[model samples]
Target chain A: MRFRIRFAQQVVGFFILAALATLVVVLILMGLNQRWFDRGYSFYSRFQSADGLTPGMPIHLRGFEIGKVTSVDLNSNNRVNVVLQIYSEYYDKIKPNSVLELEQGTFGIGGGLNLLPGKNLLPPMEPDSFLPSTDTLLGKNLLAQGLVDQPANNDQMSAILAEVQTTLSGVNLLLNNVNSAIDGTSNNQLTGLLQGVNATLRSLDSVLTESAHGLVPNLSAITANLAKLSAQLQDPKGLIPKLLDPKGSLATILNDNNQLYNEVQSILDQVNQTLVQVRGLTQYLNQSTPQITGVIEDTRTTLKKADDVMTGLANNPLLKGGIPEKKPQNATFHDLRDEDF
Target chain B: MTERKPNLFERVGATTFDLFHNTFYAFGFFWNVLGETFRFRSRSRVSTQVLVMQILFTGVNALFIITLIAVSLGTVIIFYGNQITTLVSTNFVYTILITVITRELGPLLTAFIVMARSGVAIATEISSMVVTHEIEAYLAVGINPISYLVVPRFLGVTLSMVALNLYFNLSGLAASYLVAQFFHPIPANEYFGQLMTQLTPTAVASSVVKSLAFGFVISMVSTLNGFRAQQSTTEIPIIVIRAVGQGFALLIVVNILITLVFPR
Candidate 1:
């Protein structure tokens, strides 16, 4: 009985000790949980829309959580009022010019809210003071516009794609046409056209040949005629030179017959005078014939000698071989007194 | 007239040797209970229910306050961590929570809580059973003592620790955001978004695994010490002290192992 009583007392003591230990730990945890004796002040921020904010959300200055969101509620004027449970040590950090923003992020699941501790270090926000809210994305409607303009955007893209496809098809057709042209054949009726072209070229060649044959003779005749004309012009009697020369004797005789007749008369008069002189000479020789007979006999011997010399000279024709076959027998001599100086 | 039991040192040495010998046996017994819980080849609804109940008690019930505590902790930490780290990054409130909370505080705080809350309860329960010879009674009755008592507690705490860790992490993350809203009219929109993106599933999973292992260590050490207690009132305090000390040591070692397994 005594041992059992002692064991029972011990059990009770153990329970008490366990309870005390549990109490101490719980109290410590509770104290740690609440910043029971930490230094800090509080402040209020009024926002139009809290976005997706909740009570336990962190209150960040710049990007750091300076305090906790104690409560979020709608005020009398329908503005969102957030009560901050900030540490007193961080009170000096919140400037009076701080702005709160409900920024919507582009690449995140949900948009977030921000408290921008302002840059102005003029004065700190007083405890429990309400800061005016600014920097809301109130008028921006990109999210709504994205939905409204969806179809037009898609249509634009599709139109561009179709244009690209059409252009590509045109390019392909152009390439095919070029390939046919370069290879120089097509199923189209080009064979007949080629034959016609060949025939035309043959006709052109024949015409050129005929034209050349005809021109060759004409050119030769023209050249020969020109040569003949040149030879005729070289003659003094030719009509061309007579027509071109300046008033020669033929033109002078034709134009002035009286002067030409006077010139002929003067020539005939001189010839008549020469004839009379010759006759006079002959008569004088007859008158002196008898007296000259005796002198002739005496001179006969000298004449005979002269005749002999002439006969000898006439006999040696070889000595004068280059002389003309016949000399002029009509040679006339005039009186020396009658000869003019 | 009687053979005196060995001196205190001899007895202590003998008890230590017995503990070493019985440890593997205890493990084997726990393994069998696990087998029975799952009913590998033969299904047993009763054993499974008991195992489930143990899990619910140790894991679910114990972690009920985790969310509340974690959320509040996030708020307070952000409030303070923001003040210090604001100069570094305005959004660093989330980062601080992620780096400090997920990596260390979430697991460590849970472990410490469990050690004080559950560890003491286990040690006392087992010690009372020892003083009363209930364990001896089970041996005589041809029932494994470890399966009856130790396995349930071990499995319970292990499951609970993991569950509680997840609860704490999720709650801390959510609460940090909620708490931030009150301090500022508009909170940073990308704050929590960035937080979720930064936290990987693997990180959360590792914390769970760490907590599970911690549960096993605390439960096992406390139960083992209780089982080894002589039928003396003075032995209770000693066992309790050893339980807490060994629990902490095991937690540290396990944490190191986890660190080595999965680097920061």
Candidate 2:
């Protein structure tokens, strides 16, 4: 029985030893990786919400994890303050003006702190330093509003529709007025005017028809008679034929009228000479006929007047006035206005 | 002396004092057992070998199956934890595994397994010893009964527990790798590096401290229960039951302390 108890103790001890050894191995490995003995300064970041951000979240720079979140706590003001344990090796990498941002990305994407290194050549930030984070600008309402806000454009489109509606309505009113005016016309006045013009045209058509109907018969009759006359003239015994015939009257006249022909020839010669002199005289008269006519008419008038005056002097005792007073023919016209004249 | 009727309170107090004294004696008896096991080394090599073999059977060999079971269990935990945190960087994989194994599973599983396997043995053995009057025979021979009977078991159990814990973790890590590769092939470089990085000296120290505490508790509880074993055969089962129960409870407390002292 005592041996049995001894065995039990040994058994328990065995398990304990195994557990200890494993623990030792695991710890040694972890310590080596973490470089547990390395000295480093701490940094601080303040966030509004540190969702699920526990101690030991790694701090990365350019995707390279260089440190870890050592502690997390909320202040009295409800702001989450995180303490980061950065390795001393990267002390110079962090700038004083660097910005710490708590960037929350799309769904299923965990949020993290993004450290943006500033351009200023500031000294390395001291340990336990606090860097302020920029506030999140894309508020919750912005995206939601942007998604659903299209009513304004719809309203503008409706306004154009209304304008088109008014324009169509105005055109409809003008068309209605034109339709009413055409519908209101009387057939009587239109018929009367048409009748009068039709009657006048019918009368003129009657006259033209009468002229055409009668003129054709008359012209046909005249043309028939003229044709008969022309047939007679064209007959072998016609006057033209007889005149042209050598033994006809014209031929006798020509054969028996040599003396007459010579007389006519002499007359023609005189006529030709006279025609030449007449042509010259006509040209001279064309040049000065008005002056010569005026001189002849004046001499006739002066001789008639002198005879009248001697007769008057011989018949009457009244002394003749000295040469008729000279008077202007346009004496009355001189005072008359051009318009009146 | 006159026959006196003691008051109930006085009787109760007396019983309590008696319990306290017995408890102290039980602790001493358990220590003497460990001392005697060491002393047996100088006395005779054959006896020492026998004792060692006994210790090996009870402490090391008996734990083989449990060690294998625990290793696979640890590996399964690691595999699942990795699957869950794949989105998380691989660096955290080892830390999570080490923390869970050492801080919690290692001490707890080891303590419980030993309590069940060895507690009954101790209780029954000591009860039989009482039934046979071997304790008195040892006392009559001028040999310290505790040193000869209990000390070796204490030393054996404690030492074997530490060794077994190491074996369990090693085997568990190996099994974790095999299983992980079968399920999801984690690159050897990344897995090994991550596993190394997460297992820190602080964690190792804490685990060792916890394992030692568990060993001491299990040894003390199981052996003390054995010392108190009476002649009744039923008392053996009763004591074994209590030893196992107390060992588990104590393991939990020690684990919590370890966590508070050294967190991942």
- Compared with the true structure, the alpha-carbon lDDT of candidate 1 equals 0.67
Candidate 2: docking tier: incorrect
Interface RMSD of each: 12.3, 6.7
- Report the Cα lDDT for residue B167, model 2: 64
TM-score of each: 0.39, 0.51
Per-residue lDDT for A199-255 in model 2, tens only?
A: 899999999998899789988999999999989987987778777998877777778
Question: Which candidate number maximizes TM-score?
Answer: 2
DockQ of all predictions against the true structure, Cα-based: 0.01, 0.17
Per-residue alpha-carbon lDDT of model 1 for B161-259, expressed as tens digits?
Answer: 765676676677667777777775344446644665445445655676788788878887778778778888788988898888888887888887886
Clash totals for all candidate models: 30, 37
